[model samples]
Target: MIVVIDTSSLLSLVRYYLPFDKKGVLFEVIKSKVSSGEIILLDAVYEESKFVGQKIILQKLDFLTDKGFLKENKVITKTDELIPLAPTRFLNMVKNQFVANPFQLKKLNESEFEVQKNRFMESADAKLIMYCQHLIKDNPEEEIYLVTEETPSANDLKLFKKIPAICGILGIPVITLPQLLEKYPEVDLGFS
Candidate 1:
């Protein structure tokens, strides 16, 4: 259960919005995984937390790092520039739809698509995916989990599924933060 967490799950847990528990179940799950030697976090994901300014999330990341639970994989390098190329065929279709008529306007300006693309380009998702892909390339059967809450865009769910699809091909597990809580309720999940 080498779990790779994204910021959304962490934020939700800290805000106590995703789950009804005030015990900070999300934090506990992350910590529990680390304590059990099963969690791995990308360094870029850690860096993303600084933008959040949430003391609790930062503390939890630090705590996990101190315990050697989080791994600094796919660290963002200075030379690594953001390459925001749209999906070849996907982009063409979107463009064609936009050019065709005004009826598809709502679908064109989808927030979900923008969020995912932004996340892929500048956030932890890209780093985590690259790291996981490398891990799979080397050790095909290694188990990894991607912790995130960003639902796939209605139009791009299939593209979003590529994350899990890659994981599935590589025999990894991708679960949301809420799912982790459901599975590991006994773990100490609190942020004080």
Candidate 2:
């Protein structure tokens, strides 16, 4: 199984779950998942995370990203090489799916298509969906899940959709952090 994650979900880990454990249970559990290639974060989401937090959140992020950190001599995380941006067949997949799924880019005129494509190329939400689709196409038997802390709101329209809202539209399985932990009950982090 594979999981595609967004910035909000990672932030939720830092701000919500990790706070309950000064001993780094949650961090090690997630790091193990990442090391095992089960959880992949988009490059855009990674870049966004470094700058999108308040001071406390930023400090927590720093701790997560810090190299000199240690608990029982364990590393914080080895996520530096996990970005899927290089040799991104997913980019082509995104373009191909653009005309078909969620937004229906084919329905738009050339000018509008270009505008939408340019905008979506940089959206982490779109990257998450595209990564899911890309993996499904490459490996038919894969059960990929999209993870996000986002919930749908009334303004979650077709063009400007968030991760959870868009994943629903694209028929991808989306789950919250607690739901994900429940799905994999063995990965106990000492909290729901």
Candidate 3:
């Protein structure tokens, strides 16, 4: 199983678990899985988390990278294979599910649409989706899942695209950090 984690989920894991165990038992389990190539930590998510400037988050991510537990998404350059664009159907879904919502676009002028679109394009969610698509394309036989803290919003007023929703549109399976932990119940934290 190749589980691609997003930034929010990573932060949630760090904030919730690190205080309980300074050695980061849960993180260590995740790290070990990543080292074995069962897990994937996208470079975009890493960069986004580092941008948070939280010492603990930075330290944990640093430890994972330093120990070769985290695998960065393959870099796509112009000379390399051209990066695939998000499917038109997925873009349409984003338009209908997110952008077209009156509440989400409320008080925004026509000119702001471009700004909003640009913001989404540059967002970590967008980057994560791209990486997920790449992984799916490169590894068809592998079961790929996206790990994100984001839940699909019942409220149509959300200004930004949530990770799970985007994953759904892309036909990618999505799970939360807790759900992921449930899969590895045998991992003994030895919590004193």
Q: Which has the greatest TM-score?
A: 3
Best by lDDT: 3
TM-score of each candidate? 0.53, 0.67, 0.74
Which ten contiguous residues of candidate 3 have the minimum total lDDT? 73-82
What lDDT would candidate 2 get against the real structure? 0.64
Arrange candidates by lDDT, descending: 3, 2, 1
Taken over the whole model, the C-alpha lDDT of each candidate is 0.54, 0.64, 0.66
Provide the lDDT at 34 for model 1. Answer: 55
Q: In model 2, where do residues sit more than 4 Å from their true spots?
A: 55-117, 156-159, 189-192
Candidate 3: the clashing residue pairs are none
TM-score, predicted candidate 3 vs. hidden true structure: 0.74
Steric overlap count per candidate: 1, 0, 0
Kindly give the stretch of ten consecutive residues in candidate 2 with the minimal lDDT sum. 72-81
Rank list by TM-score: 3, 2, 1
Stretches of candidate 3 exceeding 4 Å from the true structure: 22-25, 64-90, 154-158, 190-192
